[model samples]
Each structure stands twice: as C-alpha cells, then as structure tokens.
Target: MKRYTKLGLILTIIVTCFYVTTASAQGHYNVLKYGAKNDSSKLATESIKKAIAAASKAGGGTVYFPAGKYLTGPIHLKSNITIYIEAGAEIHFSDNFDHYLPMVKSRWEGTDVMNFSPLFYAINAENIAIKGRGLIDGHGKKWWAYSEVHVKKIPTSRWQEEFKRLNKDVLAPDLPGWIERGFLRPPFIQTMDCKNVLIEGITITNSPFWTINPQYCDNVTISKVTINNPDSPNSDGINPESCRNVHISDCHISTGDDCITIKSGKDRSGRKANVPAENYTITNCTMLSGHGGVVIGSEMSAGVRRVTISNCVFDGTDRGLRIKSARGRGGVVEDIRVNNVIMRNIRDQAIVLDLQYATTTVEPVSERTPAFRNIHFSNITAHGNRAGYLNGLEEMPIENVSFNNMNMDMQTGFRIKNSKDIEFHNVRVNNKKGPVVEAENVVGLQIDDVRSQKPVAGEAIIELTNVEGAIIQNAFPAKGTEVYLKAKGAKTSDIVGKANHFGNVKTVVIQEADVKEKIKLD
Candidate 1:
C-alpha cells in the first residue's frame, strides 16, 4: 500500500512539470510588469532591458513588444530568443543619430568599419527569429539626407586629384579620416557573423541606408517580409553579403536602390578579406523603383557563385536582371541560373550583363581577368523599352551564355559586344525590325529558331565584327518576315542551320527532318 502511494506521487510530479514546460514555451513574455518602477509610457528602456534580461536568465523566451509607440535606442538581440511584436505594436527607433553613435563593427560598401551602430543588432547568435506582423520604423530620413549631401560633394575625380597631390605614391584613395568623419551610416538590422537566423512577416521601413543587411551570416531565411522604404536615399531592400545557404522568398520590396543585391566584397579591402557570398536561392518576390529587380555586384571582388533566382516579377524597375562589375574588381560570378521571370515596364534593358559599371569611358582590358560565365536564362518574358545589351570587357568576353525559350517585346533587338561562345535557342525579339541581331568582337556564335516581326535592314540575323567561328544554323523566314546572317569577315562556311528552322524562340516553327535533329523538348 505504501509503495503504490509513492509511485502515484512521482507520476503526479512528472505530469505537472511537463505541463509547466510546455506552457512556458508557447506564450508571450509580456514586458508590462518587468520592473517598470514608474509608468509604461515613461522612460521604460531600462525596464524593457531588464525584462529581456530576466527572460534570458530563465533560459530564453519570446520578448513581446506590445501595442504602442515604444521609443528606444539600439536593442541588442540575444541567443535562443524570438522577438514577437503583436499585430498593433510598433517599435519606433530614436531619431537622434547620436543615440545610435559610438561605433560598432559593421560593413558598408564591402568594408568593415567602426561607425554608427545598428538599431537592432546581434553577433554570433543562434536560433534567433524576428517574426510577426508588426512594424520596425527606423525614422532615418534626417540621417539619410545628411549622408547623401556628403557623398555628392566628394566626386571621384576630385578625390583622385586630391590624393595625387597629397600622397603621390598612394594607389587607392586614402579616406580613413574621411570615413571616420561618419559619412557612411550603417543599416538597420546589421547582424555580423551570425548563424541560424530567420526574419519572417515583419515590415521594416525607413532605413538610413540599405534596409536589411546581414553580413557574414549563415543558414539564414528571410520570407514573407515586406520592406517598404522609399524616401531615403540608397535604401536597398535586402543585401546579404558574404553569407552562405540563404533563402529569401515571398517578399515585396520597394526602395530607392537595387531591390535585392547579392554581394561578396569590394576593391582591395574586399579582396584581401577573402569571403565569397554563395549558395543563395530567391523566389516569388516583387520589386519597385529599384535599380535592378535582382542585382549582383558592383562590389564583388571576392566572387559570387551558385545562385538561383526564379518565379519573380519586376515592375517599373530600371533593369530586370543586372550583373554589374568594374575593371578593378577582380572576381568571378558564375553558375547563375534565372528562369520563369516576368518583367514589365522596365526602363532599361530586360537583361544586362555588363563588366564596365559606372563608367562611359572606354579603357584597356586584359585576359588574366575577372569575368562572368556559365549564366543560363530560360523561360523569360519581358516587355522592354530599349534593346538588351550583353557587354563583356575586351579581355573577358562572357563565356557559355545561353538563352532558351525567351519572348521579348522591345523597341529594338538584342545587342552583344566583346562576348564569345554565345548561343540563342528559340529567342523571338519583336521590334520595328531594323537590326534583329548585332554582335561585335564575339567568337563561336550560334542562332537557331531566331525570328523577328519586320525585315532587318542589315542582311544578317547574325552580325559579327572581329568574330571567329560563327555559325547560323536552322534559321528560316516566318510570316513573310525575313531572316539573314551578316558577319564582317566571319565565314559562312563555319555556320550550319536549316532554312526552315528560323521562327520564334519561344515556340518551334520548324519540324525536324532527317538531317536536323529535334532538340529534345524539356
């Protein structure tokens, strides 16, 4: 009888503990009563900090930000914690830049500096999440206006001239003191060297610079988040730099700069750092008022590789898909695959692959060089105002570029310069029919099933200048529209194509015969 009573007591205790643990893990850790000695509306920054501290002391819990304008300065996020701002809650940032001053380690323009601290930041924290349908307003218009004025005053040529006179032996611009003057402000959520982070369903707006920038993080997923920041200058949506295994999806971004940018590092400072931003997947996103719908690097000296972007839409953006880098940036961006893209009302080219960025002047190029290669764009539909351009630097003509099943309605056809080993399969570009295809300084070109609405004034569907081993195979007229191949000094003997094979690149017009094998449909 005594033994049975002891067993019953033990089971009762076990059941009670299980219930307590489960209940503790699933509810809100309200900050109303966490040592707020006075009122909640008063200076409760210390009280909220204490509440978070108490939660951390008890092995991590959700720090709930209730409904109100909770004004606070920088809040440091701890590990094993999730900050859930309720549906009506808003955590407003303190406006004074001096409040976020006294510099922390952060990255701006691919270089690490000790400047303005981020509003909500963490370093090396695991299992962290910022999830809820709440607002994180940066209140950064005052700072953004100041920084833009600072950048505009300092021109590159003027800086170059000043550096030449000041320090004759210096190669790069010596701007340590200039940078120290607090010109470049940091982002809102600048988490450095963190792991296992997820930011979902939150609306982050009004950033001083780029909205959400996670530098040197791994295993991060940012989905269903709406980033709305338009007033501020250089307000990029999400910039994941030098990170790995990232997935960003279902986000609507409207900003002043590039909507989503993938970068590694920049210039001599970035190349010396040696961290590559790789292994990212972006899908189901919409962008507005940005430089590119999806962009990779004007500042990637450490390289970007193995990126896949699909099922995205760009409306009223500057360019649909842009890959930009400069001569001094010695990096390789390869293995990029883009599919199922719908672009409309784009101001510039539907797709641009340019090596010389931010320059109109022509300079010498070299072969021991940085270039873009192995890029595949398939199943894309675009309505563009101008012609798409594929410009590779003189030394590094973009290699192994393939375009399959693309349908474009533009004012002009596609133009290529200084690129080699290019292929266009089933590409139909409808325009006023001046020059359907133009290629300069290319090698080993191929065009199959390429058709246009009007007759190209130039007799060449393939116009090549300084090109070698160019081939135009299986191209024919469609709907009374003419097809021609023009190459200046490029041999027609090297080209091969059936005349009936020319039509629309999006759909096949020519049926396969004995000599021409049907490219297996995928």
Candidate 2:
C-alpha cells in the first residue's frame, strides 16, 4: 500500500512539471511537435510550413527548429515572426525544380523578374528575423549542372516547360529577358521592401546565386554570419541592392565572386527603380578568395552615396575596394570613405575606380554617363600586382578623390587617367619596377610628401602627360632615380613645385624644351 502511494505522488509531480513547462512556452511552436521528421527520408516542408502557419495564426510567435537534419522547400516568412534554428539544426533545401513552383517577384542581377523563389523569402514584411547558430545548405550541385550549358546532361524540357506554364504576357518588360534567360537560379535569402529586419548567427553555404541579398530594405542589420560558397559561379556574398540605413559587421565570407557588393541596380531597370543604396556601414569583416572585396557596382544606375567601410581585412582577394561603373550606367557615386584596411595577395590593382568598366563608344555627356566624386581612402596598406588604377571616361572625368597615409608594395605602380582634383599625401610605394606615379589627361593634381622606397634607375619617379594645374610639394625622391619629374605632354601647363627636395635624384624636373615654359618651380 505504501509503495503504491509513493508511485502516485511521483507521477503527479512529473505531470505538474510538464504542465508548467507547456504553459510557460505558450507562444513557441516547435517543428518536431508539429509532425516534422528529423531523418532525411521524408519531406518536412509541409510540416514546417504548418508550424509557420500556426505561429502566424497565434498572433505572431516564434517558429523553432531543434537540432536535426530536415529536408525542405522554400521558406516564406511572414511579419512579426522569428524563425529560430537551434545550434545543431540543418535546413537542407531540395533541388527539385517543381518544388519552386508559382513564380515569385524578385530581382536578379539588378533587374526585376518573376523568377524562382529564393530559399528564404519575404516581401513587404515588417519586424521579421532569422537568427541562431544553424546551417542553411543549398544543395546546388545538380542545379549547377543544368545552369551551365555544353555540359547539359539533363533535358531542357523540365525547367523550360515549367517556365512556359506561366503567362509571360502578364509580366511585361520582364518578358523577353525572362524568356531569353530561362530558369535562372535563386538567391539563398532575399527580403524585399522589408523594415526592421535582422539576420544573425547563421552559417550559410553552397548557395545557388547571390547569398544574403536584401532589396530596398530599411534599418536592416546582418551580424555574425558565416558565408562559404567557393567555386560556385555568380555566388556573391552579402549583396545589398538599393537598401538604405544598413549595418553589416562581423562577417566571415569566402565566395567565388565579389564579397560584399553594393548596388542600386543596372542600366534601364536600375534607373527606372530610382533607388540608391545609401547610409551603409560595413566593418569588422574578413574576406577570402573573392573576385573583389567591398566592391561597389559595375551596375549602379540610380546612384550610391554615403558609404563607410573600416577595419576590414582582405586576404587572397583579386582586388580591394573596387568601384567600377560604365558609360551607360548613369549614376553618381559619392561621399564614400574607407579606412584601416589590410590587403594581401591581391592579383590585380588594390584600389580601382574605373568609370569605363564596360568600354562604350565615346558619346556626349548625358543621362547615360556616370560620375564619381568626393571619395577618400586613408590608413591603407596593401601588397599586390599593381598599387592602384583610376580610369575615368574622357567625357565625364572622375573628380575630387584623395588618398592619405598609404603604404603599398607592388610589382607595378599607380596609374591615373582622365581624372580631376586628385590629391595624394604621405604616400609610399615600394615598387619593384616602373615610376611610382604616372598620370595622363589629369587636371588639378596635387602630390605632397610622396616617395618611392626602391627607386630604379632610368625611370622617373613621377611621369606626367597632358596634365594641367599640377602641384608637387615636399616630395623626397628615393635613391637611384634618373629623373625626379618628367613632363612631356603638349597640353601640360601650370606645373608648380613648392619646397621639393630632390636630394637623391640625378635630375629634377626634366621637362621637354617644347613644353619647358609650362613647368614652374617655387
């Protein structure tokens, strides 16, 4: 009798504990409790969607996923909900094309289209988040095999027929592009026109396209995210297009394309959208093995302004701090600043600001021309094949740029062409060959306290061609210099020297007799 009484008391206590726990977790909906299987045998997409629906119906709650492997389709997020994946959970998206049916409105490569739904998608959502330490695996091997032609092992009838099922007539302007470029891959996560967004503490890998893309979002924050998608084509990491007031920090990215690309859009579509990516701050990030680190568009059509990037490290990237736009891309990129950055093993130029990225025929300055101004770089150190390259269009020259406290070790030196109001201060280049500074078709150029560490013989320390209004002040040329300054262009005029100490140079200010009157010494 006593033993039976004790067993009843213990059962009652256990029931009380469970009831208390259930009552406390009132607004939390777990996927496992909603018939979600952990094993990979079955599709857990329906059950997970059910959980999301339940959470939404309950006046906005948390949809939780515990530690397990779950296969699923696209996850469509609603407002005022957080999809929290526990530490060891894995959400593996299936690669079957049919799973991504009923095409959604999205932007691809800076153009609007009705394309495949992104893996995690939200449109016009407010106060949404996807947080916690988990894995989002986009199994894109088969998709890649299909996207790349000439190695097409599968029939085009599958994806082609799926696209044909949609009414292209309704999707105007998006029709011919969509019809021509059939079945483009989707991004890993995309939020369109969202506000008060947050994405934190997630490790994303194997994305099909641009990973972590947010379009036209305001007050967005992405922190502590790890993105690893190497050798995958067009897989840019953290591309925020036409977004404002964005904060991106503490990210470790290694991708096949540019790591952290900022864009307003491309060509006509971008101009029509008319939204500029502005008020952005990016810091405390490390990038590895990308085409470029912190690149701002070859596709900026609307504009880009008020961007700040600091305290970043670029290791083994092709280029660092690249800003490229072409003639047809009509935009104004300005008020940009970059400081306290380190770059190593750069294959190309460390700094690139080219206005002729696509090389169009010279046309009159109109709405199709792009402009770059008011950009500054400071406290930068790099080692690369070339230190810097700045190429502006002849019609619209890049203007009002400055570089201060720069230290670079390069095989080649800096090259500038068709620019205006350029300034360099306290710059040192340890070049193995060539002049430290070379200019062509430049105006209002200023160089102060600039020197080459390892100056080679028979090469001028500074070479100028077609330059006007040039000022050289406090320039200390290095040893083994043949000529300190060479001015040869017929159009060059108003070359002024102020307190320039050419102590180690063999000759100072070697101007051709035809243009000798243009060179001035003070």
Candidate 3:
C-alpha cells in the first residue's frame, strides 16, 4: 500500500507540473505592448483588439491591462481568454455610437432581435473570464442624454412617422410602446451562448443598460462584484436570462432598476425559444435603492425554476423579492426558496407576487397563460414597508406558497387575492390601519401561530371573502379590537378556528347577505 501511495503521489506532482508549464507557455499579452496607449485621449479599440487577437493566436492566453485608463469602444471577446484588469486600471468606454456599429443577435427587453452591440460581448465562447479589481466605466451620459432629451425634441408628426417606419420586422410585435420612444441602449457586459464563465472582483458603473447580462449561457459564476449605477434609467445590476447553473454571491449592487433580475424571455418570441432559467443560487448579496432587490421578471415567458436566495440584505429598495408577470406571457415559475433575508425602508411592498403586471383585460387561457407555484420563504424580517401584496389572476391562481418565521413592521398588512394552498407559520405583523390579514377568493389556507400587534379600531383582525377550507389556530389579536374575524360572500364556509387569543374583541360578524352556508367557528 505504501509503494502504491508513493507512485500515485509522484503521478500527481508530474501532472501538476505539466499543467503549470503549459499555462506558462501560453503567455500573457499586455495591451500597452501591442500599441495600446495609456493616455485616455487616443482610441485604443484597435490596439486592444489586436492584443486579444494575438493572445487568441497563441492558443488561449490572458490579455492583461496595466494600471491606466484605456479608452476604447466595443470589445468582442474570443474563446479561452481572460481579460485581466489590474488594480487602478479602468476600461472607459467611448461615447461614440458608431464604434459599436453592425448590430448583433441579441435580446432587448426579453424579445429576441438584432440590436446594438454590448460594450463587452462574447458569443459561443468557452472558458472565458473577466477578473481583477478594476473598473469598467460606461460613459452612459451621452447615450442617456440622447434618449431623454433628443428623442423628445423630434416633432410629434415625425416621431409618429418614424415609429411607423421602424415598428415592422425590426421590433417584436408585442413590444411595449414605451421602449420604442427611446434609443436602443446596449448592455455593458453581455455574454451569450458561452460556457464556464467567471466575472469577479470588478467595479462596474454608469452603464447604458444592464451592467452584467449573461443570456443563454451555462455554468456562470459572479462573485464579489460591485455595481454602482445610480440615476440611470434601466441600469439594472446583473440580469441573467435563460441561463442554467448560475451562482451569484457576495455582490454589492445599487442601481436605478432592479438590482438582480432573472428572466427567460418575453411573449411569443420567448415561448418559441423555450429555454428556462434554472438552478440559481444567490447568497450574501446587498442591494440598495433599486426597483426590486431580487426580481423574477416582468418578461419571463419561457419559465424559471429551482432558485434559492439566502442571507441577503436589501435597504432603501422599492420592493424586495418581487415576482411579476402578466397575461400573454405564458410561463411557469416554481420551486423558489428564499430565507434569511433582512430588508429595511422599503418604499413599496416588501414581498409582492403580482400577476397583473402590465395588462388588465381578461384574456383566454391559452399557451400564454402564466402560472406560479411551490414558493417558500422563511426567517425574513422587514421594516418600513407599505404592505405585502399577492394579487393573482382569477383564471390562473398562484398556488402552494408558504411563509414561515416572518416579522414585519409596515403601514399595512397582507392583502392577498386569487390564491390557493397558502400556509403561514409563526408570522407576526404590526400594522397601522386596515385589517391585519385580508383574503379574497382564496382556498385551502392554514394560519398557525400568527400574531398581529397594535391593530387599529373598527377593523377586524382577519377578514375573509369567498375563502374556503380555512383553518386558523393559535392566532393572537391585539387588545381592544372590535372584531376578530369577519366573513363575507357565499363561498365562505368550513372556517374552523381554535385556541385563538382575541383580547377584548366585541364580535365575530358574518355578513349573511351573500353567505349561503353557516361558517363553523369553535
């Protein structure tokens, strides 16, 4: 056994040496050595491309950028290459729109189409990485200023005529009207159809669109990255669309849009692609001042599944853990688990599941019907939020959601509608006005060990409308409350309550105008 162990150890050392020697032989190509100037005045686009090409010709190597400001345009990445920016190095993208000429096959707002090239783009590449503690500054003020001010300066008649001319085959049929009013902005870093990707220890700021967007890629990792894009419209931090097996951790993001958004596709174009974004693990992230801390989508048309988020902090965000979709975007979002999240000073609902995102008209349930199910949250704490809203569609209800061990201090409590199979365990809420918990058109609900503190007068602690098969046990209502539970609608039946501590409650009223069956309360 000892002889065999010695032989194995020798083999391992030999293999390690061979790998190290091969990696050394590949060599590193410095941008400055390839006619790339450190002075930020000159355009280093061609020189940087030359360096990348030289490294690629040498059979996959590293393209190193030393400590200087390299002003360049769009950089198209190749396979088996690492763009290593050293400390104090900054790749400042030029504001020249013509530099990113020749549209590429890309997705704009969930639709598959040809658009402007991203700042750093890669297609069908393998073993690619963007590492080192440097900055990638997108001079986005020029792009944003053009969209914000110059587009509005066009005459109304000319704008309408231009819209009519450009709306055909160039854009998706179901594209929103607002997107057409502005110039098409490109993402900062977009890698599509790539595998084994890594983006770490970089600070990205002032993005024209999304900061880091990886679409239709597999085995991606983004860690210890900082994104700062404040006051820029649609400047999302990191958006992973139609990707699989992604792990994002230890990221600090503050953006104008959602900090982290996961999507598949949008509308009919997305359903045709049929590639779901699945198996994501997001942890140890901090989000600030965005639309949502971690958003699923307003554009998930294919599907999203098996996402686990934990140990995240969201501060000053509009919403936290938001899942939004609408009709005509047929998809399924399931098996999402979030835990150990802390949120503070949320402007809107901290937790929202909104199915009526963009449209309100009732349409037929076809392949465009959206479905959400099997979502679970635990150990969540939030303060200074308006309320928790869960509004599902009547035709297709959100199903099988569970919340455990939650403590929230908000202006209002839960307002749930059109859902089924919901369970809340050890949940506590302190609200100012309205009922602590209100349900409409809900079925199969179980509330165990739930408490509401300092509830206002004249409002019932729990109000139910058209609820069926509800079992509420061990619930605690605040003292001096007028009513404990109020039931309405003809479908409200089989409501069994036991061991509830209603302090100084006056009556439990059941409106008999629409109630056909008597509610069971013991």
Candidate 4:
C-alpha cells in the first residue's frame, strides 16, 4: 500500500470530521407557519419568499417549510439563503396557465426558446441552497399540452399563427434565433449567471422542459437529489448548459431524455456565444432509465472539457457514458476520465464516442470536424447486449483513447473507426462469439492482454482495415477463430506476447505451448 504524508493524513481526518459535523448541523432552519385558510394561499408565496429574502438580508441563513401542500406560482430564490423542507412537505405549483406567464431565457435541444417561467428561477446569485427532504413539483401538464399540440404536424401556417398568438407580448423583431427555431422553451429551475449555488437532498419531479437548467454559472454543487421525470417530449433531468466548476454527486436521475446532459451551446449561435462549459465532476450517481446515462452532447459547439466521472452505476439505460457531437459543430472535448463504473442491461453501446450525431440523411462529408481526444476509462465492469462502438469521422479521428482493466460480458462485437493513438490494457470481452476488436482507418494502436471467446464459425477475433503502426502484443484462446490481423497498406506492425517480435509480419500463429499464463477469475 502507498503511504500518505503527515499533512495529507491530517487533512483527510479533518475533512471527514467536518463533513459529519456539517451534516448534523444542516437541518437548523426557522419555520414560519402559513395555512391555506387565513388568506393562506395568497400569503404562502410571499411568506416563503420573504423568509428567504430575510435570510439573505441577514447575511445567509436557513428558511424552513413544514408539512403542507402550498400552492404558488414562481418561487424566486436569493443568494446566501437555504430553503429547507421537511420530509412531508409537498409544495405544488398552481394549475392555472396564466400563473406562470412571462417567459425566461432558456433552451431545449440547443435552441434558445421561451415559454412559462420555471417554478423556481434564480439569477446571478451566490451561496444558495435548497436542501432537506421534500418535493418541488413543477405542474408541467400545461406545458406538455402545448408540446403535444405542436409536434404532430399542425399545419405550418397554423403553427406559426399559434406561436405568434402565444408569444404576442414577446419582442417580435428582436427575438433570438432560438426563439425562431422553437428552442429555449421552458424548464423547472432556470438559473442564469449565478455563482456558488448548492442544491442538495431534494426531490424534483415533473418538470416542463429541462428539469434543472443551470446556464453560465460557476462553483455549483448538486448532490443527493432524486430527479423523477418520466413523460416524453423535453423532460430532461439536469442540464448543465454553459456552466463551469460543477460537481453533481449521489443523485438518482431517471428521465425521458438524456439523464444528465452536459451542454456548452449549439450550432453557430452557440459558437458565437463563445462560453465553454468545462471542469465538471460527477460521482456516485445512479442512472436508472433515460435516453442515455451521462451524455456529453449533441449541443456542444461552443466547447466541453476536463470532465471527470467516477463510481457511478448505469442500469437499463439506452447508452452508458456517451460522447456525441456532429460535424460543422466546432468543439474540442478533451481530458475526460471515467473510472469505477458498473453498467448493466444497456440498450445500446456500453461506451460510445461518435462524432457524427443526429445525421440520419448521411450527407456528403466535407466540412464536418469535431475534435475528440484524450479520453480514458478504467476499472469498469459491464454486462450488456449490444455492440461497443467508438467512431470518429474522417476529418476528426479520435486521439489517445484508452480503456484499461475492463471486463465486459456482452453479446456483440466491438468496433473502432477513424481513430488514432488507442490503447486497451487488460481488456476482456466475453462475447465468446465473434469479432472482439475491429479497427479501421486507425493509427498508433496497441492492445495488451486482450482476450475473447471465439465464435463457432467466423473470421479472426481482431480485424484491421487501412490501419498503420498497430501492435497486438498478447492474446488468449477460447474457441472459434483465434487472432487474425489483416492490414492491406498497414506497415510497421509488431506482435510480441509469448511470441517472437521483429521479423516475418506474416501469420505468426503461436500454439498454446507459446502462450502465457491464464488469468484466474474468482
């Protein structure tokens, strides 16, 4: 075991103590009583807002809400205030549509759009908290009603007319491009240009659009929150759009769209905005059901960088840890680290990095470039049914991709396309069927301690096309076709594991006598 220095040991002890002490002291908040009888509903919103405002004015304190069903429109939060709710408190949004008018700056699918303001909207604040056990329900039925009415081909002219009618008060000529594109619609908690925000230990459910949209913020911490949104059409759980220095930990998110999507911005407008969403850390979270678990982008044209996720579980999700971007969306996603993840029953690829996203028409590849490089995954265990695909486009081949100590029990093969500087260490694919590792248009590839179960009848376990400077050092045999390497113009290839290196790049078929020790799985 590695040794720690004296200062490191002292700091670790102090941090553990501080965490326990602070957790104990967290539930101390003054409760102001309000009922729905003594003009209760009318005074509840103002009372709660006043409590939070008083806390903020007094230089940071807690505002407590006891058990009750309080009706309100929009509850604006303030800096240096903590809103704590008891476990039985159920704060409900008013069902009236007019209660939530006056649109806010938000988005959906990378489009800047508008609709009813969120139930809890804060702007440009600092050191805020919404902690403790309770529910903040954004009664989203009205918003969903509008969505269902709009999606099913409502005659183009009629749709435009309805949009104009709904947004009559919106500044017509000055509305942004996203407003025109029908994005920036609505969400539950839209916080823009805020700093040092803390959202911990709350249940947020039934959001209109993106559940918790944090745009252009810094030093935000979202922990131990259960986000539940099952309805379709723009019900994302937690979208960190154009934010920096975020840490999301110990959250269970199940939503209709991407569970926890990281977005910088979208398209040329996003690029022109020029705000890079960077330095996010997600740990100890569980993703139950969603389009994808912890997705990076289809909306990352501005940029996304330096993300770290660890000790997470993805179950029954479409994909586990996906990084996707399209062509002409100029962004660089680099230095991503995913470690200690366990994925089960993945509907799609266990780990996927695709550069061409949302392009079903398959246009001619000309000006499509999105740089993906330096991504590392380690100590991951997966059991799934689909293929594991890592695809980079012709113009933007991936660079420095590494998968170390991965044990995958899968049903399909693994593929890599148009990539460079890839490494796989101690990687075992128990496909036991066929095509374990396939690479095309690759360069600087290395596979160490890679083993697979062969198919009953097929080609080699490894296939290479137009790849250069590739090395397959070691392999283990199970059944079908063992290890085959085919490269037409591939040069400078070396295969040296329990076998000779240097010369004769032909089929150096080494027998079991020349193989190394077998691994023991307990």
What do the candidate models score in CA lDDT, each in turn? 0.74, 0.87, 0.86, 0.72
True-structure RMSD for candidate 4? 9.6
lDDT of 4 by residue, 155-261 (tens): 34443454456655543211133345432336777777899888889998888778877888998899999998875557878889889999999999998888898
TM-score per candidate, chains pooled: 0.83, 0.91, 0.91, 0.81
Ranking by TM-score: 2, 3, 1, 4
Model 4, position 429, has a per-residue lDDT of: 82
- Residue 290 displacement (Å), model 4: 0.8
Which parts of model 3 have CA positions greater than 4 angstroms off? 1-26, 148-175, 508-512
User: Which is the winner by lDDT between candidate 2 and candidate 4?
Assistant: 2
Poorest 10 consecutive residues by lDDT, candidate 4: 513-522
Candidate 4, lDDT over the whole model? 0.72
Candidate 2 lDDT by residue in tens digits, 299-404: 7888999999999999999999999998778989999999999999999989999998874789899877889999999999999899999999999999999999
Off by over 4 Å in 1: 1-23, 26-28, 35-45, 149-151, 154-182, 360-368, 454-460, 480-483, 489-493, 499-522
Spell out the clash pairs found in candidate 2: none
| Model 2 lDDT, residue 79, Cα | 85
User: Cα deviation of 163 in candidate 2 (Å)?
Assistant: 4.1
- Backbone clashes in model 3, listed as residue pairs: none
